[model samples]
Target: MSLAPRVVIVHRTTEYEELVARHGTHGQAAFFLGSRGRDIEEVAERHRRTRQALAEVSAAVPLTWRQARVERADLDRFLFAPEDVVAVVGQDGLVANVAKYLAGQPVLGFDTDPGRNPGVLVRHRPGAAPALFPSVHARNTGADELTMVEAVADDTQRLVALNEIYLGAVGHQTARYRLGLEGDGGVVEAQASSGVLVGTGTGATGWLRSVWQERGSALRLPHPSEERLLWFVREAWPSPATGTSLVGGELAGPAGLRLTVESERLTVFGDGMDTDAVELTWGQTVRVGVCGERLRLVG
Candidate 1:
């Protein structure tokens, strides 16, 4: 006899639920929102709809499969097995949040409200879980293999970013760092900038696009499924000890970027989760490159 395949549904607390949890009651939450010129009823309705969608998905799971539900906040601590299929029940960002932790498992992203959250990642409707499960179980589903960016520090501590990786001062202020890139040979430069951004093809439209807009470059960005990555040094200052020549470029094939922390403290975080970050002191080196694992997202 074989064990039943497990389905893990990932979700987050709705706005109304969070407000009530913090305020200890609906009355207090309403009062707080009313003072801010926000209507509590709107939030409450959204919460109601989100719960209804989740309930529908729960009811649609196959009867023979084992099931579990996880909140977004608790994903860092939750243990996932090799045979688990992840069902993300939230906006697109939630899919990125969960992508870094997965290796080859198939992910089904369900947008609770398609009207408000128009997403590229979360394409399926909540009620589509039952129809989506069989293909995922057989591993022949239509999916996109999204590349990821990785930052390895001291060769041990590392972070895999599904969207992009940020490296800079702990406060994101202008800081000092020795930046190096591996090309045909090798190039190293010192820079005084706000920070550095390394993003994957899937992230080109997000923060990477903003950075590209500032440069006004004519170069085309990578597509969402490409095996390439982009790097940009934000606001590189031309000073006596630093230069701005190697500010932006593409990293492909065997090329990568290295940063030596010249400031008192530097932090490296992935997918905009600042809480789950690695801190580096002066003289520490961190390498940013393509990750070995990829995100298998079912459409």
Candidate 2:
């Protein structure tokens, strides 16, 4: 069996050398710098004191050692090959994950925030790979949002995403989309507000929070449920008479759609990513997995 690859990081506040001395340093590594502890010994000593206080009854053990610190974009540019395993001590999105891999950790991850959105599938593949290779994918959100990209040959990679694809408003018009949801008998069609949040446990945090804060949306990103949360709303002018308010909770679906403000455009926003509105018409609907996948996380 192959010995699993290891890379230790004394992140944000953890002591690097202390980890080394207490855990021993045979197969492990270290990379940390703190102002309080100017040298490695100081850091290690503090860790010893802290540990003694915490594990009053037990003894501290040494750890496996193999560590380094490399933080540059040019140097950090690589993907996770199936044969590698990396350990990390930080938090970041996909881009950050890629950077860590380049930093040398194969299987890298921090704690998971159930409140944020999950891993999303890139609508377009990012780069070119060799003809054949092996890869993996993880769902950042719910059970259905599983996405994996495996190599077909020596250097090729194929990706699969579980969540839905999104199109943000650019500037011309609203990014209108006819939302399609899974129904008991078949599929249900409806008009979405600015954007549709097809999410899992992970998605509820970011986009859902903005929705609640911005529009005061009637819905909360309910915890990851068996059923996907769907929001349908259309942009329209607030009528002085009895129409919905275009300010707060104004963008709503059938239950609140008072009238269709036949303006020049309509569009949706995703994760507050859009600056100028993206032009969308009544005829387009994007397809995305939206469901989440299971990903093992290390503390």
Candidate 3:
């Protein structure tokens, strides 16, 4: 007989009871967002009646409680479990780590946009392509560690991205970057500009397009360039734009095109996470993509 799948329902500490009652997508489920002294009683009262039902479903309970980002070792233990399904129920924020845990497994994540409140669904698949970003690194994860980057990349699957992969100067002046397209045989000129926006189709109208839409004045981009998600730094906005251009002054230091080949040090960020201090002189390259793999967020 085939054993039933176990689902690890990770959420804010408060939602434990309700999620367990619904038995979301599996017989066994774990909640990995608990606090040490968190008042479960307080959560029960505010969330809903499901907590009360959770008390009754103790028999079907495969409940695994979690401590939120308490430590690297702790997260490794909770996520690397050999469970059948790891249903990460939350915004797109925590999906990356969850992806790290259930590498090469049937992964799902709940996503939220400007219109959609946070919801849950599948985020990855065993054979599905990885998302459009540089590979995930298992950093500082103790001495003996195996990162998922290699395992996931081995699978031949396209990735899905929900927004823009952006990098802005953090502590110093805004830097500059040279742009060159990857696929075509010809090399394009290195346009002098501040940043880049490499995103997926879903991300197009949102984060990627905002710089144009908010400014209400996009540069006269050609048809092919606009269709593709890759963009270069051409315009500058000193203040926080509704969507168009970098809010230059608000971001790094005096924003006179932070991205530059001369300075040669770029703070490379992907999916809103700052990762490396890039050396531009060597043209150090990092692979980032807004991959194609979004799922239906069932209510």
**Which candidate number has the best TM-score?**
1
lDDT of 3: 0.35
Please report the candidate that would top lDDT against the real structure: 1
Which stretch of 10 consecutive residues in model 3 shows the poorest summed lDDT? 143-152
Superposed Cα deviation of residue 169, candidate 1 (Å): 0.9
Output the better candidate (1/3) by TM-score: 1
Error of 3 at 179 (Å): 1.2
List, residue by residue over 49-115, the lDDT tens digit for candidate 3: 3233222222222334221222222444564444343344334544443443343434344322212
User: Model 1 over residues 208-284: C-alpha lDDT tens digits?
Assistant: 88888888967578887777888998989998889998888888856789899998999998888998888999999
lDDT of 2 at 83: 39
Candidates in order have lDDT scores of 0.87, 0.31, 0.35
Deviation (Å) of 75 in candidate 1: 1.3
Candidate 1 worst ten-residue window by lDDT:
180-189
**CA lDDT, candidate 1, residue 241:** 89
Residue 58 local lDDT, model 3: 24
Output the lDDT of residue 291, model 3. Answer: 26
